[model samples]
Target: MENLPYGALAALVGLSGGLVLGLAARLGDFCTLGALESSIYGGDHRRLRLWGIVLGTAIAGCYLAQAAGYIDLSQTLYQSVRWNPWASIVGGLVFGYGMALAGNCGFGALARFGGGDLRSLVVVVVMAVFSFITLNGPLAPLRITLFPQIGAESSQNYADLISGLTGLPPLAIALPVAVLCFAWALSYAPLRRSPRRLVWGLLAGLAVVWAFVGTAWLADQSFGEVAIEGPSFTAPLGRTLIYLMTSTAGGITFSVGSVIGVMAGAFIGSSIRGLFRWEACEDPRELGRQVTGAALMGIGGVVALGCSVGQGVSAFATLAYSGPVTLACIGAGAVLGLRHLIGGFQPG
Candidate 1:
């Protein structure tokens, strides 16, 4: 432990949590767009309800760790960055629509790529390139001009805000919200029957908590050299690419570890399920659509400051204001995109 660099330690922490997330996505069918599509068009709510379990467990675990002094929520970008409602709404909508067209988010693309889907490899690369374009490339200036992300005066989250209002401890508000989420998930008989799915959901949530706690500890040990962060696929995807391209210039970090871990875990999960098969986009039109969608996702994710799993799960675990609002907008945008694709926009 002493011999390993602080960056390596952070990478290890990210790897551990990311592996669990990847496993959850593959083995448990825990996916953002898939859930929405299933619930809305497929007439199945079990996958959608699984979100309750994930959110409930994450919320509980994070707050519990906070109370125990294992992690500080304020260090996270979700809390540190000033809340931007317009950014959340607009970025989320774009990301969601792109997700619908591409058929995957960054995380999902990585997972599918791991499962030997060559098409997902395209999505991943395109998304990564565009993410960098928006994050630090040409579009960065425009994004900043439109949605300037300044530092917050203090930590910003639901628990903090509600606590301020009620004069109660943050834990007092967080635990009940967690309980409500669990209750909502368990209310679905189908989801309740699937203990495997439930277990994976719980593990998925715990992964987010693990990311924060592990990164927090590393940040302390490194005297702030290491940043406190959770799993976020958007910018991380770009970071991973940079690291891969310039190993000598770029040092190993959490983002690299996380991106690799997801693919590794997804491969394992795919092998276990006998789902590993080489696949590719045979349709030029489909490929074009996917590339375009990936570009949109990259740009939107940068503007929003997180992707679906990033905001929907990791940020939400911290009870950040950006989490729920961004998630809702993503869902709405995905629905609109899906409707358009399915000819629901045919003068109806």
Candidate 2:
């Protein structure tokens, strides 16, 4: 902390969090799409409960960190961005539908690619490329015009909003919600049966907290451009892609470290699990669908301001207004896409 460069410290923080996330994906089989799919079609509550555990843990961990004065929610992007209900719904729908079409979100694609899935490489590349396009390229203007984001006036986040309305401490509202979520998730018999899933879900949530706390600490002490953030796999993907091409141009940061760490962790996990094998798309049509899906996810994520992991876990951790709403919309959109695919494009 005292001697290490800020960039190096940020990367180390990212790698630490990413390793936990990758292990969760590989060993725990924790995935947003998988959780949604099982709940919607397979009559399984375990995966969904697993997500609840993650979200609940994240919420508790974040608020606890705030309570301890470790991190500030006001500094985070989710809080900084003005509440945009319509944008969240629309962007989440687009991103979710695209995720279903591609068969994976950006984070999932990276994990797959790490596990020797060649098709996911294409998805990752296309998604990153288009994310950059929307982030700072041609689509930037349209996104800004359609969804102009402004800062909140009185509150930093929804918890603050509620706290102000009810005249209670923000943690007074956050802690109970987190506790109820954890209780509900643990009450599920099937999820209770899976201790490994529970542990990994906890680890996943803690990973986000780790990143937030570490970076916030660094920003507090160091004199650098340290934006308080957590794990997000959208614009970071684009940034990572660019960094790969020009090493000297973009220095090491949390996003770059996180991207590589997840891949490395996934690779290690895949090897340990004896699941390392190269796989590619067999049909061109499938490839086309995946590409289109990747593009939509890139654009949609920028518009929405985060991806599944970004908004789902990180934003939810902060109790941001957009988190739950966007998550629900994404789930709804995925259900619609999945239904269309399963029903052979028949009207619902």
Candidate 3:
């Protein structure tokens, strides 16, 4: 049974995720950072609040999924406390700033690719490559060398800090608070007026969360089956690149499946909606933004161990102690970038 053909199964899950992403992209137009930025500038509450509503739905869906036995989140890697705590927060901050600059995060970049955006192509390529470099390329040794040497013992992880502060199990405080915060965010009265967008936003949010949960599950089924489960990008991106370079005895990797499915799904969904617009950067400054944003995302993603979708949404719903901390730092970083570099880009 262990040797059974699970490759197709894995691909199917990945394809479903991509289709969900493309459908959401073509439908809801949800991206929190972008939506927030747009709101700040245009004073339009539609997209911004839609982002929040999506988040609320994602949180609710995640909890429901876990309760339904779709995922035993305790098996997730986020619970492991061996890594540097400061890294997640610091990395999230930098990644958030970079996301603002690139005008997209990991998921956002993938969604934009469906729209035939060439500038995003550049950003995604650089991000994937640099992600490889940081996780395993020439930079790997340097990361191992610098990480322990830089942060204090106190810089372990957000959960450690929370446990220290509240004297309770991290999950005890994190889960309840996350649910409450999401509920408050979604309860914005004006947003309830548009039921169509509300339904789309909720579905989009669930699609993203459950997609990763499925990825982790697929990975577990790939071999003799391991109990450990996690959804992260830094190492997975590097591994996916390596898999592309050479075929080996290692099991099927879900990241590769997920990445491929997004392109295919985007192609199909865009064609269906007649929203296929091939885009390129006309302004030279846009090129600079892409390069800078890509580099920042690569480095920051490695340090934080995830992009926005990975940490902010996916990991957060699991009630992982680090999730909230990383999200807050990421948001703060985005706020900083908007204040200093892209002040003209505001969120309503």
Give lDDT per model, in order: 0.91, 0.87, 0.65
lDDT string, candidate 2, 110-176, tens digits: 8898899999999889999999999889988988899998877756577888888899988889989
lDDT of 1 by residue, 1-348 (tens): 889999999999989888998898889988999999999989989899999999999999999999999998988999999999999999999999999888899999999999999999999999999999998899999999999999999768999999999999999999999999999999999999999899999999999899999999999998998888989999899889888998843589999988999999899998999999999899887888789888889999999989998898888999999999999989998888888879833221
Please give, for residues 1-348, the per-residue lDDT of candidate 3 as tens digits: 355456545555656665665566566666657776777777767766775665666655665666566765555556544455687777888888887787777667776787798888788777878887887678878866765433232323344367688897644544565566556556776667767667767776676666656755765665424323333444455555566777543445556666666666667767877888999999877778777877788888887767776676666666555676777887788777777665464321
Candidate 1's TM-score: 0.98
List candidate 2 stretches off by more than 4 Å. Answer: 1-3, 345-348
Q: What is the Cα-based lDDT of residue 169 in candidate 2?
A: 89
- Candidate 3 or 1, higher lDDT: 1
How does each model score on TM-score? 0.98, 0.96, 0.79
Better of 1 and 2 by TM-score: 1
* Cα lDDT for residue 60, candidate 2: 91
TM-score of 3: 0.79
Indicate the residue-level lDDT of 280 in model 2: 89
Residue pairs with colliding backbones in model 3 are 36-347, 37-346, 39-347, 39-348, 40-346, 40-347, 40-348, 41-346, 85-156, 85-157
Clashes of each: 0, 0, 10
lDDT of candidate 3 at residue 247, scale 0 to 100: 53
Task: Pick the TM-score winner.
Answer: 1
lDDT computed for candidate 2: 0.87
